[model samples]
Target chain A: MEGFLNQLPIGLSIGAVLLLIALGLTFTFGQMGVINMAHGEFIMAGAYTAFLLQDWAGRSAVLVALPVAFVVAGLMGLLLERSVVRFFYGRPLDTLLLTWGVSLVLQQLARDLFGAPNVQVLSPEWLQGAVGPLPYNRLFIMVLAVGSVVAIWAYMNRSAQGRRMQAVMQNRQLAATSGINTGRVDQRTFFIGSGLAGIAGVGLTLIGPVGPTLGTYYIVDAFLVVVAGGLGQLRGAVIAAVALGLLNSYAEFWTNASLAKVIVFAVIIAFLQFRPQGLFVLRSRALT
Target chain B: MLSVDGLEAGYGRARVLFGVSLAVTEGQLVCVMGRNGVGKTTLLNTIMGVLPATGGTVTFEGRDVTRLKPHERVKLGMGYVPQGHETFPQLSVLGNLLVTLEASGNPQSALDDALEVFPRLKPLLKRRAGFLSGGQQQQLAIARALVTKPKLLILDEPTEGIQPSIILEIEEAIERLHASGIAVLLVEQYLDLALRLADRYVILDAGQVVHAGTAADLQGEEARRLLAV
Candidate 1:
C-alpha cells in the first residue's frame, strides 16, 4: 500500500511531462497533418535555452527560460514551416521524410555546438525540497502542466487569433473565403506548437539531464500519447497522458522499466484496433 | 465590378476550365448555368482565388487580382459560398459568424445585421453548426458569408440538397440581398430559380461559355437545349 501510494505522485508527474510534449503534436500533427519528427529537437532547444539562461539568471533561470524558450523554439518552427513544410502540405509521406531529415540535421548541429555529452541543469532552491512522496520539482511540473493547459484552453476558446486558427484547421478553403489568411494561420499554428515543445523542455530539465538527443528518448512516447488521445482533441490528450502515465508507473513497479513500455505499447495497439479514431473524432464536413 | 478574361484552371494535370470568360457589372445579378461536371464550380473557385488561374486575368474593381490569394481577394470585397453548405461543424453558429466578422475587422453589429437577414439563426446561435439541420446549416453558411459585408457575393449552388421551405427562405434572402444592391454571381442548376434571380445569364459546356445573353434570351429554346444533358 505504501509503495502504491508513493507511485501516485510519480505517475502524475510523468503524465504531466507527457502532456506537455504531446500538446504541440495535437496541433501540428492533428490539425496540419504534418508529422514533425523535429518536435523533439524543439524540446531540446528549450532545454538548451534554460541551460544557457543559467549563466545570466542563475537559480531563477528556469522561470525566465519558459517564455524565452517559447519564442526561440517558435521562431525555429516558423522558419521550418516557411522554408520546407509549406511546400509539403497535403503530402503526409513527404512531410514525414522531410521532417525526419531535418531532425537528423538538428541533432548533428546540437552535437557540434554543445558537444555530444549530456549536460545537467540545476534545480532552483525552491524546487529542491520534497513533501512526503512528492518532490517540489515534481509538484512544480504538475502545476506547470495544469497552468499550460488552462492558458491553452483560454487561448483556443477566448482569443480571436485562436478562433482564426481553429477556423483554418477545420476548413482551409472556407476559412480563406471567410477572409482569413490561411498561410499566416499555418505559420502561427506551427509557432505555437513548437513553442509548447520548448516549454515542455524547460519542465523536463527539473527531473532529468538535458542533452542533445534528449528529445529522441521522449519523441516516440509523445507521439503515442497524441495518437492514442485523438487528433486535435485537448481533453483527449490530458486523459490519455494521465492514463498512460499511471499505467507506466504501475507496470514498472510490477515488472521492470522496459517491460512497462512494452505493456503500454501493447495496450495502445489493442485499444487502437478497437477504436481506430482514438478517444475522440473531430466532426467536420470539409471535403479534401 | 468583376471581370474574368479567358480564365483557365485545372486539378493537377487534368484541366477543368478552358478559356472561360464572363463579366458582372455593378449590382448586376449574373447566373452561371451548366450541366453536371461543366466547370461551373471551378470557375467560381478560380475567380475567388481558391484555385489558381493557369492562364488569364481577373480584374475586380478595376484592379488585377489574378495573382492574389483567396483571402486577399476576399479582403478586396469578394465573398464566396462554396457548394455543400460548408461550415466549421465544430464551431457554434455564433462562432461561425464571429470568425469571419473578426477576420474582416467588422464590428459585433455585423452579427446583428446577418441575424436580421436570417432570424432563424438567432435562437440557434449557441448550437453547434454540425448539429443543425441541413437547411439550418445552409442558412448559417450564408449568414457566415454575409458577416463579411462583401461587395460581390459568389455562391455555388446555395439551394442544392435543401428542403423546399428552406429553399424558399434562401431564395427570399438572395432576393433581399440583390434588392439591397449587392452584386451576385449565382451558379444554379434549376432554370426557373435562375431565371427568377438573374439579370443576365451564361451557359457553360465542356469548360467553355457556349452561350451568353440577357435573362430574356434564356427564355428561348437554345439556352435550355444547351443546358440539357
Candidate 2:
C-alpha cells in the first residue's frame, strides 16, 4: 500500500505529460488525419526554448519559456503547415514521409545550435522540496496538465472558433458550404496544436533532459496514446493517457522498463483488435 | 440577381457541366431538375463556388464571382444548404447556428428570424443536431443558412430521403421564403415540390440545359423526355 501510494504521483505525472502531448496529437492526427511525425520536434523546440530562457532568466526561465515556447513552436508549425503539410492534406503517406524528413532536418538544426549531448535545466528554489508526498515539480506538471485539459475542453465546447473547428473536423466540404474559411481554420488548428506540444515540451524539462533527440523519445508513446484513445475524441485521449500511464508505471514497477513498454504495446494491439475505432469513436452522418 | 453565362465545370478530365447558362432574377424561385447522375449536384456546387467553374462568368448582382472562393461567395450573401443535411453532428443545433453567425461576423445576435421560420428547432436548440430526425435536421440546415442573412438561398435536394409529412413542412418553409421575396435556386428530385414552388424551370440532361420554360409551360411529356435516365 505504501509503495502503491508512492507510485501514484509518478504515474499521475506521466499521465499528465502524456495527456499534454496527446491532446495536440488528437487535433493534428485524430481530427485532421495529418500524420505529423515531426510533432516531437515541436516539443523539442519547446524544451530548447526553455533551455535558452534558463540561460538568460536562470531560475525564472521556465516561467518565461512557457509562452515563448508556444510562440516559437507555433510559428514553426504555421510554417510547416503553409509550406509543406497543406499540399499533402488528403495524402497521409506523403504527409508521413515529408514530415519525417522535416523532423530529421529540425533534429539536425537543434544539434547544430545546441549540441548532441543532453543539457540539464535547474528547478527553481521553490520547487526544490516536496509538499507532503508530492514533489513540487511533478505537482506543477500535474497542475499544468490538468489546466491544459480544462482550457482545451472549454475552448472546444464554449468558443465560437471552436465550433468552426468542430465543423471543419466533421466535414470540410459542408463546413465550407456553410461559409467557414476551412483553410484558415486548418492553419489555426495546426498553430494551436503545435503550441500545445510546445507547452508539453515545457513540462517535459521538469522531469528529463533537453536534447536534439528529446522529441524522438516521446513521439512514439504520444502516437500510441492517440491511437489507443480514438481519433478526434478528446475524452478518449484523456482516458487513454491515464490508462497508459498507469499501465506503464505499474508494469515498470514489476519488470524491466523495456519489457513494460513491450507489454503496453502488446496490450494496445490486443485492445485495438476488439475496438478498432479506439475507445470513443464519434458517430456522425458525415463519417458514414 | 444571378446569371451564369456559358459556365463550364467538371471533376478533373470528365467535364460535367457544358456551357450551362441560366439566370435567377430578383424574387424568382428557379427549380433545376434531372435524373440521378445528370450533373444536378455539380451545377449547384459550381454556382455555390464549392466547385470552381472551368470556363465562363457567374455574375451576382452584376459583379463577376466566377472565381471567388466558397467562403467569399458566402460573405457576399450567397447561402447554401447542401445535398445531405450536413449539420455538425457533434454540435448542438444552437452551436450549428452560432457557426453561421460567426462566419457572418455577428455571432451573438439572437436567431429570431431563423427560429421564426423553423419554430420546431427552438426547443431542440440544445440537442445534438445529429440526434434530430432527418426532417428536423433539414430544418436546422435551412435555419443555419438563414442566420447568415443571405440574399440568394441555394438548396440541393432539401426533401431528399425525408418522409412525406416533413416534406410538407419543408415545402411550407420554401413557400414562406418565396413569399418573403428571397431569390431561391432549388435542386429537387420530386416533381411535385418543384412544380409547386418554382416559377421557372431549367432541366439538364447529361450536363446540358435541354429544356427551359415557365413551370406551367414545361409539363409531363417534356419533363419525362428531359429527365429520362
Task: Report lDDT (Cα) of residue A260, candidate 1.
Answer: 91
Candidate 2, residues A1-288: lDDT per residue as tens digits? Answer: 777777788888888888888888889886578989899999999999988998799987888998999899999999999999999988888999999999999999999999899998777888778876788999998898889889988988889888898889877888888889999999998998899889989988988899999888888888888988898888899999988888888888879899999999999999999998899988866446
The docking category that best describes candidate 2 is medium
The C-alpha lDDT values of all candidates are 0.91, 0.88
RMSD of each: 1.4, 1.6
lDDT (10s digit) by residue, model 1, range B134-212: 7898888888889889889999999999999999999999999999999999999999999999999999999999999
Give me the runs in candidate 2 sitting further than 4 Å from their true place: A284-288, B107-110
Model 1 ranges with Cα > 4 A deviation: A284-288
Every model's DockQ, to 2 decimals? 0.72, 0.69
- Per prediction, fnat is 0.81, 0.68
